[model samples]
Structure formats: C-alpha cells, structure tokens
Target chain A: MSQEIRKIEELARTIRRDIVEMVYLAKDGHPGPALSITDIVASLYGSLLRVNPSDPEWEGRDRFILSKGHACPAVYSALARRGFFSPELLPSLRALDSLLQGHPVMKKTPGIDMTSGSLGNGLSIGVGMALASGYTKKNFDVFVIMGDGELQEGIVWEGALSAFKYKLGRLIVFVDHNGWQSGASCNDVGGCVSVKSRFEAFGWHCQEIDGHDISAILQAVKNARAETNLPSVIIAETVKGKGVPFMENDNSWHKRVPSKEQYEEAMKILGGC
Target chain B: MSEYKGSREAFVAAMTDLADKDPRVVFVSADSLKAARATNFAEKYPDRYFEAGIAEQNAVAMAAGLAACGLKPYVVTYGGFITMRACEQLRTFCAYTDLDVTFGGLNGGMIGGEREGVTHQALEDIGIVRTIPGVKVFAPADAAETYALAKAAGSLKGPVYFRLGSGREPDVFSPGTEVELGKLRKVLDYGNDVLLLSSGFVLDRVLKAAELLKAGGIGASVVEVHSLKPLDADGVVRELERCQVAVTIEDHTVIGGLGSAIAELAAERCPCRIQRLGIQDVFPESGPANTLADKYGLSPQAIADTARALAAGKGR
Candidate 1:
C-alpha cells in the first residue's frame, strides 16, 4: 500500500473508533449508519477534500454534505479529528446546547457545509452549490453522502435530474449502500433496482466500489473529478456497523446504544483502548 | 375602471431590477417562467436563471443551496406548488437554516387559478408558511405592493415567502407606493365604528365594502395587512380598540390565516368582536375568478354585510 493510502486507512480506523465512542457516550445515535460511512468520510476529509479546518467557511474550499444526517457521528468525528474543533467535543454528540447536533446543522456545526436532517435534501443543495461555483467561477466541488434507503425519497431523483440538466460536473454523490434501513433491509422496504442504472439513466457518471477500501474510494473521487461534463455517483458497498465484529450487519444496532460489555468489545475490535 | 398591471409582472420587474443591481441575484423557476412572468428576467440574465422543470421541491432546496453560497436566489412558481408541494423543503432547508431565499408564489388565493381550479389556488399558503418559524410571509394587495415587497425582499437577511396574485388582479394601490415591511398601511378611516382588516388581492373588495358600509350609515376604517408574519400587532390592536368591531377580509381560508392572526391577537391583547370574512372552511369549486371570490365569501357585498352586522352588534 502507498503511504498516503495507509495514512487514510489509519484515519478511517480512528474515525470508526470515534463513531463508536460518540454513539456509546451519547446513549442515543445511529451508530450503524455512522460506522458504515466512516471510511468514506475519512477518505474525503483526510485525503480528498480540499478544506481548511481552521477556516470552516472558506469560500474557495470544497463543500461536503452528509445527506443521511443521522450518520453525523462519523462526520463530527472527522471534523474534530481534522482540527475543525476539539476531539473532546465528540462525546457530547447529542447533548443539549452542544455545537454538534444529532443531525448536521451547518449554522450550529463549524465544518458542516449544509444543514441536513431530512433525507433527500443534500443532493439538491449540492447541485445549487455546484451551480454557484460555475456562476462565480470558484471551481469548487460539492460532495454529498447519502444512505441507500434515502434513495426512496422522490426529491433525490429530482435533484439528479437538475444536476444532469445543468451539467454540474463538480457535484459528486456517494450512496453508502449498507443494505439495511431502520425497520428492515433496504430492498425489502423500497428496492431501488440497480442504483448504477438509475443514476446512469439520469445521465450521471457512475462507479461502484468497496466503500471501506480507502484507496478505492479515493480513486473513484479522482475519476469523478476528471469527468467535467456530468455529475458522478459512486455507489459504495458498505457494511453497516463495520469494524466491530458483533455489530457488523446487525440492523438492531442501527440506533441502539451499546452495553458496557458491547462497548468494550467494540473498542477492542476497533483496536482502541 | 382603474388601470392595473399584473402582480406577477410587477414581481418579475422588481426581481429584474434587483438582478441588475446585485450580480448575486438569481432566479430558479419550476417550469413556470411564463406563469411567473419571469421570461424578461430569464432573457436579461440567462446565466443566472435556472429551470428546475416542474420540481418545486428541488427548486426550493436548490435555492436554499444557492442562498447558502451567499447568493440571493428567488424560487418562483405557483403558490400552491411552492407552499404545499415543497412545504417540507421550505421548512427544513430554508426556514430552519434561515437562508436568504426569496420565494415568489404566483396565483395566490381564490382570485387566481381562474380555470385551473382548486388544485392551483393557494388559499392556505399564508397559513402554512406563516406557521413555520423564521419565515417572513407577505401577501401584497396590489401590483405596486408586490413590486415594492419583492424589491425589499432582496435586501432582507432571511427567508421570505411572497404570496402574489394572478396577472388580472384589480388595482388597489397606485403606482410608486412605498410599502414598508411589518407596518400596516392604512387605506381609509371614517369614524372607526368598524375596522375592515384586509390582506392580499382582496383589498379592493374591502375598499368597496367600506363605501357600502358608509352608505349604510356605519363609519368604517380600512387597513391593509401586507406582511402576515412580524405583523404590526400594536397598530392592529390600536385600530381594534378604536372600532366597535373588527372584520378581517382575505383571499384565503378563515382558518389559520389573516382572520386567525387577527382573532389570536385580539384575544390576547384586546377583547373585541371580530367577524372574519373569507372562505368559510370549504373547498371552492372551479369557476371564473370573480365568481369563485363571490361564492367563497370574499365579495365586496359579503365584506360590507359582515362589517355592517358586526357594527350593529348582530354578528357571530
């Protein structure tokens, strides 16, 4: 592995540990969803996205939106680890009056680019941001990470149509295809037949990769950036509650808090003290 | 007949003027460019105009995004579509975030959607939008007021929803009327035996009702409520205190709209008898705009009758 890839993998491990700890400490959060996107979040914040942690609202910086905002533990961890805020704030994930909200609120959080809690809004916001980049000649890319089940929202397709119609090349979306939703499997609830074909039908550049593989995720982004005439969607196949053996692929862990034994087991599995 | 321009035309003209002054001003249309009378704006600033193709939800969310990027974005479409179809997007994306997005909702109330029917009319827009926190709701009485509010919205710092009329609305305010936000513009006042509180395109009817009340030996004061949210509560209360009874006339449902605002305020501040003259809690059928207005209790005769009865202490 290249040194850069190794560094990103290490960062992903740290972010996963942070996600576990944050959810465990808060006693209420979507840990499975957060863990699913930890590597993808790490890949973007640690290696790909051009952002200034000290200056969160830098005009020229690329923007990131976690559209599946219930997964904000991963983003909060990524932001804290990248020096946007103190990592000490991670434990207060859903605490009252904390800067970190249960959902990603751009006004409240320092590093959050868009306020998103309602599913299917982030991509449209990204389309607007990307359009702004063209109008202002900023040339900054807008990235959005959505959960697989969020595809069921009709507005997501509407955003897809706008991105395609406007030819927003700077807008990139990653569908964290973890397969499980809150109540049941995503397919059982609402089967989005062939996520790749669906986006491709909208004339978007499409790629599918292992979401946990930091190197592959980085390469997909690189390829997405190369395509300047269309929006790109990277369907990242992820395992819900990844990096923890007992929690992996367990839908019950979607929003459940871990017991002391489960917490210790998760920490040990994540290679953290 | 008094000369009048379409409120939609005035809205587009004001937006065009705003765009001419500020380069950050942009327009997002949901396939209603012609309906919004925004073709002139599109022609003037082609690059700044976005066509969202009948997707009001996406249009609103996208406008929120543009606003977040420090650009002033105006999402223009039918009032029903903008307020009802994209209600969640407006609440969560724009109002909750407090983005500076100016929304121009055309065909507001029973006076619009002449042939398009109940599906197109926006009788509940003010009620739905005003309930959302951090949203400034404006239902302009005339083209002049629409132009002034649209221009003023450009300078405001938060989300604004402008409830506009169809192109055929009658002239209430003359040209070059300076309409301020959150201030009640008094139209006419006699002995203050009854207060005629009006909003949106129904102001002309209310004015005619005041003349009828005068003919019936009931002195009436007329006040136009353009801004529904951040309402001039003290001014309205003062008028309420002076009058023996207050009647709220709007081109909307009596529930959760101008009438509700007046009733809520009067109940809290000054206990006064109020007869709300609007749609009487029923879905209006498709008909000519004038016929619909008359059937829905928004006619001049209805307003005058209500005011006359309330003034005589014979109203509900």
Candidate 2:
C-alpha cells in the first residue's frame, strides 16, 4: 500500500477508536451509524475536502454536513483529528455545554457545516449551499453524509429532485448504506428499494462502492467531480458497527453503548486509546 | 394608519426590495408565486428565486441550506403548508441551527383564504412557530407592518416566521411607521377599564371594537402585538396590569394563538377577567373573509360585545 493510503487507513482506525470511546463514555449516541461512515468521513477530511481546521469557517473551504446526524461521533472525531478542536474534548460527547453534541450542531462545533439531527434535512441544506456557492461565484463543493435508512424521509427525495433540477454538480452525497436501522434492517422495515436505482431515477451520478475502502471513496469522489452535469451519490455499502468484531453488522449497536468489557475489547481491536 | 393594501403584496414587494439591495437575499416558494405575488421577483432575480414545486418541506430545508452558504433565504408559501407541512424542517434546519432563513407564512389565519375552507386556513401557524426556541414569530396587522417586518426579516440573524394576512387589510399604521422588533404598539389607548390585545389582520377589528366600547362608556385599550415569539412581555404585562378586564382577539383559533399567549401571560403576571375572542376551539367555516370572521364571532361587534360583557362583571 502507498504511504499516503496507509496513513489515511491509520487515521480511519483512530477515528473508529474515538467513536467507540465517545459512545462508551457518554453512554448515549448511535455507534452503528458512527462506525458505518468512519472511512468515508476520514477519506473526505483527510484527503479530498478543502478545509482548514484552524479556520473552520473560511469562506473558501468546502462544506460538509452530516445529514444523518446521529452518526456525528465519526465526523466529530474526524474534526478533532483534523485539528478543528482539542482531541481531549471527544470524551465530553453529549455532555452539558460540550462542543460535541449528540448530533452535529453548526454553531457549537467548529467543523460542522450545518446543524443536523433530524433525518433527511442535510441534503436539502447541501443543495442550498451548492446554489449559494454558485450565487456567490465560489467554486467550493458541498458534501453531505446520509444514512441508508434516512432515505425513507420524503424530504430526502424532495431535496434529491430539486438538487437534480438545479444541476447542483458540486453537491455530492455519500449514503452510508449499512442496511440496519434503529430496531430493524432497512429492507425489513421498508421494502427492498434499490437506493442506487432511486438516485439514478432522480438523475444523480450514482455509484456503489465498498464504504470501508478509503481508496474507493477517494476514487468515486474524483469520478463524481468529473460528472459536472448533475449531483453525485456514492452509495457506500458499509457494515453497521464496522470496526469492532462483536458489533459489526449488529443492529443492537444501533443505539447501544458499549459495556466496560465491550469497550476494552473494542479499544484493543481498533488499536486502543 | 396611512396606506391601504394587501399584506401579501406588501410582503412580496418588501422581499423583492431586499433582494434588489442585497445579493445574498433569495426567495424559495412552493409553487405559490402567483398567490404570494412573487412573479415580479422571479422575473427580476430569476437566479435568486427558487421554485420548489408544491413541496413546502423541501422549500424550507433548501432555504436553510442556502442560508448555510451565507445567503439570506426567505421561504414563502401559504401559512398552512409552510407551518404545518414544513414545520419539522423549520424547527430542525432553521430554528435549531439558528440559520438566517425567513419564513414568510403568507395567507395566515382563518380569514386569510376566504372560501378555501379549513384546509387553507393557517389558524395555528403562529402557535406552531412560536414554540420553537430560536425562531422569531411575527404577525403583521397591515401592509405597512408586513413590509417593515419583511424587510427586517432579511437582516435578522436567526430564523424568523413572518405571518402575513392575505387580501386587503385595513391600514393599522402609517407607511413609515417605526415597527421595532419585540415592541408592542398601542393602537387605541382609550380607557383603563378594558385592554384589547390583538395581532395579525384582526387588529383592525379590535381597534373598531375599542371605538365601539369607548362610545358605549366602557373604555378599552387596543394594542397591536406585531411580534409574537419574543413577545413584548413587559409591554403586554404592563398593559394587562392597568385594566380590570383583558381581551385578546385574533383571526386564529382561541387555543394557542394570541389569546392563549396573552392568557398565559395574564395568568402568571396579572389576574383579570380575560376573554379570548376568536374562533372558540372550532374549525372556521368556509366563506368570504368578513363572513368567516363574523361567523366565528371575531368581528368588531362580537369583540366589542365580549368586552362589554367582561366589563359588566361577566366571566368568560
């Protein structure tokens, strides 16, 4: 593996470790979705996105919104790792007056582009940002990370259609297709509707990839940037509760905080704190 | 007080003026351009005006996203759909985030869309939006107030829900009335016997009722509460304290509208025989604006009669 790729992979592992630690300490948060988008977030922040952690609100920086906001731990860890805030603050997740909220709040957190916790809101906000970028003559791209289950929200499709209609080429969405929802699998809850086909019908430049692979995410983003006619969606097929062996693909971890023993096991598996 | 026109027209004119002055200002409508009088804005600033079909939810969220990009976005639609359908988005994306997105809830209250029935009425829009923490809710009584509030909404920091009545509303203030945010303006401060607090297009009715009560030797004070959410508590409470009887009249339902807001305040601060004169917890009938207001007991005579009853030691 290339040295740069290896470094990114290492960062993803650290992010995963932080996600587990944040959820375990807070005893609150959705770790399953957090872990599901770790690599996608790591790839975006580590490689593709033009951002300055020192100047998080720089006008020229690319914007990122965690639409499936329950998955904020991964993005929060990435922000801290990117030097947006202190790494020590990660343990204070969901704590009173802490910068790391249960969901990504823009005013509270430095790197968060838009405040999101309610499902299906991020993409619409992203479309706005993309349109604003055009209006202001800024070339900065807007990225939104959404959960697979969040697609059930009718607003998502509404935003999808509008984004396509407006020709928001800079608006790229990464759907963390981990399959499992809070209590049941997405297919079990809502009938098997191919997310890729849905986006295709909406006229998005849709691509499917192994979400765990950092290189694949980077490549898809590059390909997406090439398709300037429409908005892009990288349907990253991820495993819910990805890194930890016991939690991997487990629906229980969707909202479950790790026990002391489970925390220790997860820490060891993700190369520890 | 001076100029007379439809609040919707005034709202659209003010927004278009803001769009002309500020490049960052944009308007997103849910295919209600004609109803909202935004065709001129769409023609002039085509790039800034977004037509989001009949999707109020999408329009609101899209406006929030636009605000995130440092642009001032105004989401315009009928008050019913804008407040009822896109309510969650207004709370989550706009209010929670404190985005600079103004929600122009056109055609507010029971008298807004005459003959359109209960579905078109936005009686609970103010109550619905007032509950949000960071959202500033305003119900303009006339074209002047609507224009001033709409102009101010573009510059406000966080989310603002500006309630505008449809059709021609009586001129409650002069064209250049200094309508400050979170300040109540006394329209008729006649007597200390009764104080009538009102908002939206119903202020004209309350003022007329105050005149009738004054003529009948029962003095009534009419105050126009433009801002509902950061409600001028001190001003409202002060007015409430001065009178023996208090009445809140609106074009909305008696529950959770101006009446409830004032009653909630009166219950805590000042104890008085309060009469909430509005649609008394019932679906307003479909008819002309005047007919609906009259049928729902929200007309000037009905309000005056209620005030007369309250002043005569009758509990409401």
Which candidate number would show the highest DockQ if scored against the true structure? 1
Clashing pairs in 2: A125-B65, B1-B171, B1-B172, B1-B173
- Pick the TM-score winner: 1
lDDT of 1 by residue, A40-110 (tens): 99999888899999899899899898999999999998899899999998999989999999998889999
Tell me the TM-score of each prediction against the true structure.
Answer: 0.98, 0.96
For model 1, which pairs clash?
none
DockQ of each: 0.86, 0.81
Q: Over the stretch B180-240, how does candidate 2's per-residue lDDT look in tens digits?
A: 8779988877888888888889887888898899889998888888888888999988887
| Tens digit per residue, CA lDDT, model 2, A104-215 | 8888989888898888888988888888888888889999999888899988988899999999999999999999888699999977999999999999999999999888
- Candidate 1, position B252, lDDT: 86
Weakest 10 consecutive residues, lDDT, candidate 2 chain A? A1-10
lDDT per residue, candidate 1, B206-252, as tens digits? 88989998988989999999989988999999999888588999888
